[model samples]
Target: MPYPPDVERWRELVSAYFAPEDVNKALWVILHESGGNSNAIGDSGSSLGLFQLNINGLGAGLSEQTRFTPSENIRQAAIHVATTNNWTPWGEGALFRGEPFGSLGNKPYPGDKKNEFAEDTVAIPGQPAPPVINLEDIDEEGFELFSPSGENFEGQFDGYTSNLEFAEKRILNLVLEHNLSFDPNQGYGKTTTDELGDPVFTLHEEANMWSEVFFRSEQGLERISALRDSGLTTAGRKSAEAFLDTSILENAAGQKNFDDFRSRIDALAAVENIPIQRATDIASM
Candidate 1:
């Protein structure tokens, strides 16, 4: 069977940058680091490309364009690995310390869990296969550490407005009214309504995915800009700044958790000016 196009591309690049003996190992690392997505931007936009390198620190001297390009990104990663003589720059490397390669084959080394990526490899047959790391441990922890949630709204709007409370409320309402919630099941953002025809605000999972999808589109940016220009009491300006910073797009998992969206509607009912029942009715509507 053929390799995934992106995976095959990375394999060739890795082989070019690494020694014949190390090509398999390099391929293993790239698989875990990026799952072969050259455009994969993670670590809240601080990292880019196949290696998810933080060029500002360990990736020092790499230009923005170089970091974003797959070939250049892989080349720089190979250089970084050669210079350090280890994999400390990457999460899996740093987390595992000395055992940067994880388990090598069908068996788990000591405490290491069995890695399925090892099975996923396209072996050359007769040659020693590369060790595919068990990244589940890192993934669970990383998701918790990096997943964006509504709870971390602190400083999100700094320099945009001082009215955090009103701005947040207005933003939530706008998100609901504009049907910005993305449904992956349909590959688009759409308004869902209950039996009464009241709009159903996005669920936490849907909202999180939508944050990533919506912020990547032109419409999302225009909306953010419009909101920002609307007023200090609204979140458009702050959101726009976040949009520009890629905080709302590439790094949305850090700021767009939808639980807050759900709670805010209930809280909005408590506002003395809005009357609880009316607020509830508005949410249902």
Candidate 2:
């Protein structure tokens, strides 16, 4: 039989009402309970199709007859589940997630394991939380990853390692020292309709790029500090500062910044009568 017209509509409605993370899981729950058969009736005879809705003793949504409507069933169920994080609405199926139900969807409510962890670790009393991260975004070796295929995922993780790893270390230190949120389940990774709690990228590589920017900027600031500390002539320090000040750090990065920073180091080295390598090395510190 053709699927009920209500399926997509209900999914749309659920995505709008709940977090994106809930929509897929809710759909999978429907898939398991009804096999996407809108007319499916449980052996218990009370539960209806899609979300196994029992309009009879259910909430103030529809009647038993209307419960068979796929979209209507999903809408009611999603709204009900939105009120609480309880998956007992799924019965024993909640305990055993596998095929037919698809991947175990994340908990939708604030109290679910993910949200609880986010709250414990991510929530900032006076500020917004940073992008949420998942255990899936990392590997057993503690490397941030974008794909699940180990090192063989898309793009060159190893190629980006030196810069990527350095950036990762800096950002991670920032997050931990500042008590920022690294919670994997921030009610993210859902379809477009769901509420994105904190900022998160869709790909691991993109996240790495974001971290790289911060690391580079920190390095820029260090260079400025170095010029100030070096015992160079006044003109030399001013030249270095003018060449590698905050503007260099804030502007769009390119080869120009590198050229300018290197030039400034050279000038400082010449003025101080030190080897350019030694002067550059001191600034790097």
Candidate 3:
């Protein structure tokens, strides 16, 4: 079968639905094996889709009816890759092992040694490629951590403002209101100290709360910038900066506000034909 001219589109669709970085290699291998065509449903009975997924284990969230659709096929294939090999850029080495030249079969007209390759010889390109399969990465133990499903102290503050000061106030108030033992002398710094005269907010507890605050709010970046301006410690600034630059914030309807913010920034930069650097400097204040 001739390869699809729209292979790149198919690749993009699949990558979007699954792992973008590793999809190229997976597509390369699958193309080598199945000629980029979804196997006929009847040919392998239980097998379906581009990667020949068994209907019973379609964990990729692909419906059997859409098995042949290029996008669906790629999505399922990518999910299969993730599940079977733990396809992450950081764990590729452990996920694949080199095999003998002919181990993957020579049916694809295996010829020159340089050109001919084994199934596992292919590699995923990108920084910090998926890690080799590690037991630590897999959660095989049946033990499940206690996760609250209902609204509680943590739930009430989820997606709350990213400002550390706000977070501190909330923690302090919660502790006092609940009569929890936390020290007040420790202060509401990034590190949560039991100095609040409370056991509820220990050092580890403080760290986790700060993490949650940063993860949930856009103000985290501004807070970090403010901290830097005030000559405060930069211990957690790296993550806050990165999150501000790359993460997207959304409204109740899921409309992204980052683009709007960026546009406003750009407009401020363009005002009076001010240079972007100068505008950014002014806006930072």
Structural similarity to truth (TM-score) of each candidate: 0.32, 0.28, 0.28
Worst 10 residues of 3 by lDDT: 142-151
lDDT of 2 by residue, 1-285 (tens): 222443333454344333465556665565556655555655556666556665454523455534654334654664455555555566534433322333332221211111011211123334443444443433444444322111232222232454344444444333333333322332111122236566443433333344434334345344434443543334444455456545543433221233443344345556657666655643342
Q: Residue 225, candidate 2: how far off, in angstroms?
A: 53
Q: Which candidate gets the maximum TM-score versus the true structure? A: 1
Quantify all predictions' global Cα lDDT against the true fold.
Answer: 0.44, 0.42, 0.37
Top lDDT prediction, candidate number: 1
Tens-place lDDT digits, model 1, residues 77-144:
66556556565565444324123544321111112221111212223334432223222232232121
- Model 3 TM-score on a 0 to 1 scale: 0.28
lDDT of 1: 0.44
Model 3: residues with Cα > 4 Å off, grouped in runs: 1-9, 56-63, 83-285
Cα displacement (angstroms), candidate 2, residue 231, comes to: 56
Ranking by TM-score: 1, 2, 3
